[model samples]
Target chain A: MPVRVAVDAMGGDHAPGVVVEGALEAVAEAGDRLAVLLVGREAEIRAEVENRGGAEDDRLRVVDAPEVIGMGEAATEALKRKPDSSIHRGIGAVKAGRADAFASAGNTGAVMAAALFGLGRLPGVLRPALPGYLPTPTGTCVLLDVGANVEVRPEHLVQFARMGAVFGEFFLDREDPTVGLVNVGEEPGKGTDTVKEVYEALRALGDRGAIHFVGNVEGRDILRHGADVCVCDGFVGNVVLKLAESVSTILPDLVRAEIGRQGLGADHARTVGGVLRGMLAPFDYQAHGGVPMLGIDGTVVIGHGGSTARAIRQMVLSAARLVEQNLTSRIARALADDDAPPHP
Target chain B: MPVRVAVDAMGGDHAPGVVVEGALEAVAEAGDRLAVLLVGREAEIRAEVENRGGAEDDRLRVVDAPEVIGMGEAATEALKRKPDSSIHRGIGAVKAGRADAFASAGNTGAVMAAALFGLGRLPGVLRPALPGYLPTPTGTCVLLDVGANVEVRPEHLVQFARMGAVFGEFFLDREDPTVGLVNVGEEPGKGTDTVKEVYEALRALGDRGAIHFVGNVEGRDILRHGADVCVCDGFVGNVVLKLAESVSTILPDLVRAEIGRQGLGADHARTVGGVLRGMLAPFDYQAHGGVPMLGIDGTVVIGHGGSTARAIRQMVLSAARLVEQNLTSRIARALADDDAPPHP
Candidate 1:
């Protein structure tokens, strides 16, 4: 009855070492409720698993993958050429019903392609979205299409909102998540023609109790977490995500240097620096491993290329939680209900 | 002859008090090189100016404006109805050649409308952009059309890039400022159709030695000051601007809270907080008083609604600097040159 998560052991920056370590950690921490399928070069992954003190019980398994998708290679190209890649094999396991979910710290494009091609998109879901959780000054908020669908239509945005709402309900435990369309301004007539149309659609959807729509939210609101779910085209969402990460990295370092120049005591300076670092550290996607490709037939979490043991552990844990909560099923049901016409 | 700047004394959140204080500060700091024409309710401004401990010096004068523009009113409506409003009067003074520039911390829309109507746009300049100096992680960079020209064409974007370049040269003192179009990606075929066309135009302009065109830059590059000037439609630019401000405000608070819970000394915490605050403080546009509306016939700096005395002082100083730099003339020359067809 343990939630089984298939992890691409050869897919991340830290590779077998971090993936193995993370799997062990997840299994240990999750007790008997979590199982991990380490899919990679059999001999290498086996050695790594043994190095990490071996699996606690039958809750762990090793699936061999002959190849890997490089971080720099085009994701779609790599998926076609490298069918035996660990990321591909891992996703296959989930689709084949060998694993409940799949997690990878590999190329995002490859993971998305593999998930869509391997498992397929759910009903009424035109495109899958990479939904990311950003910690804001007020609280944490979810942003969809962080990098998944680059060119999206009004209908795509509607689906993203629905998927994001479902994810938030399962993860953040928010009842009737307040959904907001990320726009240039809060005004109704702001942004491009696509945004305007989407705004109208979202407004209509909200009126019918599909979701608790909060209307349009500006860029600053992305970090403010003014709404539980924030939906935008992948281009905008990706930009927002990258910018927030860059700011988190650069601003704190600048602040620390400035503070150090002021001749603050070493102990105090380090403590303050530590505090600032912790506050910003979460923004680094490596810590969260990867983003989840929502609206797919099965749960798939994409990790960053530079993910480490801790990040991988978090990814595994996230995957298990997604499966346990039956997030995909809930999202599919919502989409189905949305597609159905209203009765008078 | 000292550069004269008209101040809308009755505008902004801390109006009259802050505006008067800032004007006096600018006059005192700039010595005889600058003069301020404070336009507002004559009695209120005089009382505030008198309370500032400086006598009615030769460099400072007050003009009577019976009405004031409210921040909530639409810009076009406010400008059309309140002809004798403080902002309108200040702009009128510039039009009448009584002042070299006009500065206001009133409603941005109103100030923009008044400037366009009174001062008029320069030749070859389709729209006047509101450019602000955003303090990035690397250094300060210029972001154009933060809220000006919301619906922009490819031609408008080219103009924005040119205007931003001029701004960088005048304020940042860059000899050959590098200009970039803010897009979702750095690839040649990234972003929406609008951005792609602008990219091609910029490339063509860059080849002619008009400006150092740096191709496309993502949101992360904004705070990095990757280029001297960052150009985008008003919507995207405004989003970036507001997001940066929000991050600047929230990041410090998060750090402070963490440090506080750790029971760090107040002085040490303040030191850390101060550094974080300082990095973000420059973005407090109100602190700097006003931002110049580049490419206009005369100088115009739009201040924040929450402007204080210090902000007004900074705005006054900025206005004087713009006059000293001959920003408007330089912008006109650049625009004329840019509009010319390339040589074989």
Candidate 2:
């Protein structure tokens, strides 16, 4: 059966336009292998599609989703209030097995709330995690609970590690992905009680070949490519994710300042900017498209609100890959094993 | 009385040498204005001092503290087991009224532990915070609970704001520094119950000029120079601190990659490197020296393990500024006020 993916066409900064463009791009690239259901206000979605020339591919379908959940709206309240929001309706399609996956670039909390309430949780998973990738010189590192379940239990962290490792193996195409528990210090006894317990549980799982535990890693290790996957409570993970993002925000100013410091004029600086842009491509957040909301029963990808058409395309493709690999089922199978260490 | 500052000469990675050089540099710059007590193994300190020539001024003192505490040791256990460690002894000097402030580039947890047991908590203070400076092109921003109290209550966060605001005024030389509560999102009702309550408490206090609350700030708000003082529980603060530090860690390699992409030889790249380093100097972690351990009874500065002689010098100068300003007393007075809002 062709893999079906639901797109939140009303989500993100440049919503219907970029989202529609992205869905069309993915269909063209994936050919008959992929089907995209653009879910949003029917009129807007149609107008966007018509603006870009009618949806020429039979694989592309527009589903009427009348409400739009804003980027800054309260996730739970908005989800409950706006039943027809692209996020809600799109996620509902995945829940009902009409779509194999769901993707959005709107409010992260709303996307997660939709996953929790609509698509529902996977077997043996208490809290799902939003896992994002950070570019490292060697490749990429997986970091989760980036913005899902901000207040997580110790056992929730263990589940994140198991799920993150499985995701990493398929996503990064690596075997027995090494998992590191993020903490204040690298030593075993450094962090809170929750971290200590999670470490012990991960260690137990590692001994049984369920995961590759790399002991403790600090925040610096995430970008340093220290492990295949790094797990932490969403609070800390969110801060790390944002802080890494700031590096991009500041670098351009630094380069401009450097040109000024060297007494180079605006024209000279603009020429230098082109080269610096190429150099900075790896640091761009949009390159990754979106981060995945894992531990849910269906594939769900949440991109930044300012996502570009290219980023949307990347997000659709990523969700399609997870769907093809049966990532959610793999996570469920891993968490279900009796040999898996019990959460604290 | 002349302000006496105790230096942990055997603390950081580049101990004795950088620590001694830093102390000497601070004394040379301050002349008769400040005094530094180099506390560590007397023989090693003396040899290092003599190697660099005996103290140039009487303001520099070398105290005999025979034991040393390693960085990775558990804080509470290390403090109890090694009373003679420089961290314990230096803080003790402050407690005994022999030293007005203490600075260390060693173990951070050990420094906090020393402040808790040695100097003791200030009256009306529950948990202390470590406030550090993040340099922006415009100026510097203050981030507290950097790594002091890992887990904290809403009241402790309020305390952090009061303390951090007072600090930014004297340290960054701002009047009524605007305070932002570090959170996942900037909206009114984002984040956990603890964050929401802290927002209300800060708001109530802001109405009274207890703090200049600017509402919630997301992770990206930091480093963008969003607020003067940003407060959060130490766990999230620590992650932000480390992730920012990675910018310094990775910038060199990134510059190298860019130069390689430009097809420049090693010699040309080295020349470009000198210019880039000059531009990147403002982003250097060492430029700020050490962050202060605020809310304790005495002045305490905790620096990075990878501190250099210049960093140590900056650390000494920073602590000296706090001692000169009577920062500890100001914080004590602020917390003692009857109108101070109770923890939510």
Worst 10 residues of 2 chain A by lDDT: A266-275
Q: Write the per-residue lDDT of candidate 2 for residues A1-344, one digit (tens) a residue.
A: 67898999999999889999988888889887899999998988888999988663558888898889998888889988988889988988998889999999998888888888887788888888888777776678888888776787888999999999999998789999889998877878767877888888888888888889999988777788889999988777777778777777777887777777788666556556755676678877767697677888889988888999999998998889888888989989998988884464
Q: Write the per-residue lDDT of candidate 2 for residues B1-344, one digit (tens) a residue.
A: 55788999999998988889888887878777789899998888888888887663569889889999997778788888988889888998988889888999998888888888787778888888888777765778988887777778888898999899888989888888899999877777767888888998899998887778999888887888778999988777777777776777687787777777778666566555665676668777777788777778889988888899888988888888888888889888888877774453
| lDDT of candidates 1 onward, in order | 0.82, 0.83
Which ranges in model 2 have alpha carbons more than 4 Å from their true place? A265-271, A341-344, B265-272, B342-344
Residue pairs in clash, model 1: A289-A303, A290-A302, A290-A303, B18-B309, B22-B313
Fnat of each candidate: 0.56, 0.53
All models, DockQ values? Answer: 0.50, 0.58
What is the CA-based DockQ of model 2? 0.58
Q: Candidate 1 DockQ score? A: 0.50
